[model samples]
Every structure is written in structure tokens, then in C-alpha cells.
Target chain A: MNRVFTWQQVAPDQWRNKISELIDSGFFYFDFLTGVDRENIDGQADCEVVAHLAKPDLSDSRIIFTQVKSELASIADLAPASSWYERECAEMYGITFTGGDTSPLLRHEGLGRPPLRKSAVLAARVLTPWPGGAEPEIREDGRKVGNVSRRRQRPPGVPENWLSP
Target chain B: MKHSFIALIEDKCTSCMLCVRECPAWCINLDSHTVEVTEEGARRPKKVNVLDSFDIDYSLCMYCGVCIDVCPFDALAWDEHRALTSTNREDMILSIADLRPSGSS
Candidate 1:
């Protein structure tokens, strides 16, 4: 199906008002809202909040986005359907939506860093001995080959300091 | 026909770590070492990577078949044979020996 993509960038403080303006302009259908981690990008906000709204007839759609550090104004009051999305964004990216429900969406309360954030380390890669680290010391015939010298490589998402002695 | 699990063709695998890196679930782990092999009539010993170990944690695997598609050597394949099951979470981690097809030694 053909679709129209119209994106608008709004300030963090004007996020809620923009959603209201979109709804008044017949963009009442709320598709989805999500957060994107921008920590790795240069000269950008720590996080970006994006919301997609469409007309009921599926004729046109509008994408509203705003950049925020760790918090932004909540649009759940205007859209109502965005409440769960707001909570998810808060849980995944650690972006707090003021004036909205900031309770735990899928994870337990006070459970370390937000996993979707770029800085969050993959704990599983660190805790478990990676199969890629296998080095056979003894041959099948029972002869010791001794240690082989090679540059150690860290698994993806694991910090260098975590493996440092 | 019912598909069971992913199996590894040990001989064909070069231990490139493509499956481990591309796995979205981060369920695959691999390790390899370099060995200096002196070929006959060659003046210098060439460095070769020896596959040490490869393991796939079934508990975390989503069975997305990413590893099978990314393997350049065509080392990974889908097996119709049933996969191993256990009550313990640790037992779910299948090693290189466990991943091999039943027909191969």
C-alpha cells in the first residue's frame, strides 16, 4: 500500500503540544512510539523519541520526533495509546517521560542500566566463557602443546577493562 | 517434514566467527588458535587458525537461522533429527561435539 511519510522535529518541551496539534489536524491514529539511543552519534542528544501518527483512512502519516537528554514531556495524555510506549521507552532507554506513568514495563524495578542504551554491556558475553576462546593444550595422543601466544580478542559488547587483569 | 535444530559441519568450518558475531540472540560462542604449519618445500612456516571450540546455547537461541545464512563455508545446516533436551539450564548449552550430526564421527 502506498504511504506518505512526513516527519517533523520538535523541541523536548513542545513534544506534547505537537502531538495534540497533529491529532487536531486529523492525524488521530497512533501507530507506535519508540526511543532511539544516540549516545554513539556525534553532536546529538543522548536519546530521540519518535512517534508515528496516521489518518484513519491510511491516506497520510506524520512522524514526530524530539531529542532529549534523559527526560521529555509526556504525550500519553493526548494520545492515550502512547502510555505503554512511553513506559517501554523509559525502561529500555532510561528516558523519563514527565507527567506519564514511569513504572517498570517489562523488567523488574532497579535492574541495572537500560539495555537498549549503547553503553550497556552484554553481561552474557562476559559471564559465560565464549566458545571462541577455546585453546587446546593437550593433543589427542596425550602430548602437551604448551601455551600459544596470540592477541586476545574480546567478544562484541564486552568492555576492554572487564577482561583486563 | 519437521525441522529439529541447527547442526555444525566441523570439517568445513573455518572458525571465522561470522555466526557468533551475527547472532542477534548472542547464543553462539567460539574460540580458535593460530598454529604455525611448515609445508613441505616451503621456506617459511605459514600461520593457520585451528578451530578450538564452538558452542551454541539453545536456551538463548531464537532459531532465527542467522548463523546458517551467514556461514561462508556452508558449515552450518538445519537438521531434521531431534535436539537434546534437559531439565537443567546449564545442559542447554550445546558444545561442538553435541552440535555435530549423529551420522558423522
Candidate 2:
């Protein structure tokens, strides 16, 4: 059995340099890369991105995580090393990761708002300028796997069953 | 029984196809720019092309949820209430006819 281990989570800004350094040195197996949005749940989400790395060979079970804990109110532009994962976080959650590969991966033009963020007003404001209304394109079984999220999501203070579909 | 439902957000999805490339049983398909899961007898796509050749031997599925997590679009989801059935061999084999969309009933 493969032993499981968890590496410490670091602040968000240092994430890129640290990860790049690890990749440069040896650990090439980029295993896990995702972000957390603590804006409502934990207060804030900036600089809270997570990444994982390990050796390709199964010998070393150690996992390393690099986090960047920096936050920004707004962005005039983007920084490098923020790749697809980080860029997506920045665009959706309003957090920025410094470094390279800094282009938004999933965000497209004409969409008015990010859906996943814990804001009801903002989600309703989300608009798509296209003819088919606003829905990101994902296809399953050779057909569009179109879905809409959180149309009637309850606020943190409201009861879970209070909001009816 | 552990039933669950999961959906990948298309806008948030990167189309990386990691889940497509990683499924062990070849149950997932990447044709329409996203990922689709067909098991038991439920299917959302009427005529599956990319994920057409899907047949998951539920007996072999460990329910690890790796494929769901691997999806870059975050499209693959879990419906915790609907766990894999511990029935006979034929029933154990899930095809595209099992899954129906959320509001279809």
C-alpha cells in the first residue's frame, strides 16, 4: 500500500517560486493543483492556492504543497507564473498568484460574473452575451453538458431549507 | 449505499482532459469538449459519440473518485446517495442508460 502524507500549506505568494524550484531540482510529478475560496467560509481566499508535487517513482511518498497567501482588492493586470490553475482562481475568486503562465484559462469574454463565489447578487448578475445565454461549454457524450449553478443559493445566515427551488 | 451527484462547471473547466486520459476502465469519453459519465442505465446524452464506448464494471470500481477529482473542469461530480449496487454480475455492469440529468424526471 502507498503511504499517504500531507505537506504543510504555505502562504500563497511564495507558492510559485517554491514549486518552480522543486520542479527544477527533481520532483517532476505535479500531482495536485487546486485552490480554496475562504472568502465566506474562512473570511478570505487570496494567497490560498494549493499545489502538490512528488517524485515520479513511488519510492518517495512525501508530498509537498506550496501556497501563496497574498490578497489583492482588484487587478489592473496579471503576474506571470500564475498559469491556468492560478489564473482561474484569480479570475473566479478574486485572488492573484504571482509568477509565470499568467493567463486566464477558463474565463472568457462577455460573461459578467464568476459563478462559484459565495455571492447571490453577483451570481444573478452573471451574464453571457452570446445567443444561447450564459453557460460555459462542456460536452459529455458528444453533447453539450450544459449546467447552471446556484440560482437560488441561500446566504450564510439563511436556513438551508428556507430557499425553495 | 452511498449515492452522490457531481457536475463539472464548463466555464471553470479547462478542458485538460485529465479525467479522460486517466479513467482505468475507459468509462469516460472526451468528445464534446467536456467529460460524461454513464453508468447503471442512466445516460444524459442521447447519442453518445466521444464517451460512447463506455461500460464500467461496477464490480471493479473501487469508488475512489479519482476520475471525478482529476477532471480539470471540475465537471465530474458525485451523488453520495446513489452508491454502487452490490447486485449480480449483469447488474454490476453500468452502461450509458443508467444516468439521467438532474431535472429530467
Q: Best candidate, DockQ-wise?
A: 1
- Candidate 1 stretches with Cα past 4 Å from truth are A1-7, A102-110, A122-124, A135-142, B1-4, B21-36, B49-57, B78-105
Report the lDDT tens digits of candidate 1 across residue range A56-131.
Answer: 9989999989888888888888999999999999999999889998778789987889999988887766887664
Q: Provide the lowest-lDDT 10-residue window in model 1 chain A.
A: A133-142
Best by lDDT: 1
Model 2 over residues A13-75: C-alpha lDDT tens digits? 454456656666666666655555445424344334555666677545334443334452211
- In model 2, which runs have C-alpha deviations exceeding 4 angstroms? A40-47, A61-82, A110-113, A120-165, B1-105
**Deviation from native of the Cα of residue A51 in model 2, angstroms:** 0.3
Q: CA lDDT of A154 in candidate 1?
A: 67
How good is the docking of model 1, as DockQ? Answer: 0.33
Model 2 chain A lowest lDDT segment of ten? A125-134
User: Per-residue lDDT for B99 in model 1?
Assistant: 91
How big is the positional error of residue A70 in model 1, measured in Å on the Cα after superposition? 1.8
DockQ, computed on Cα atoms, for candidate 2: 0.12
How much of the real interface does each model capture, measured as fnat? 0.27, 0.24
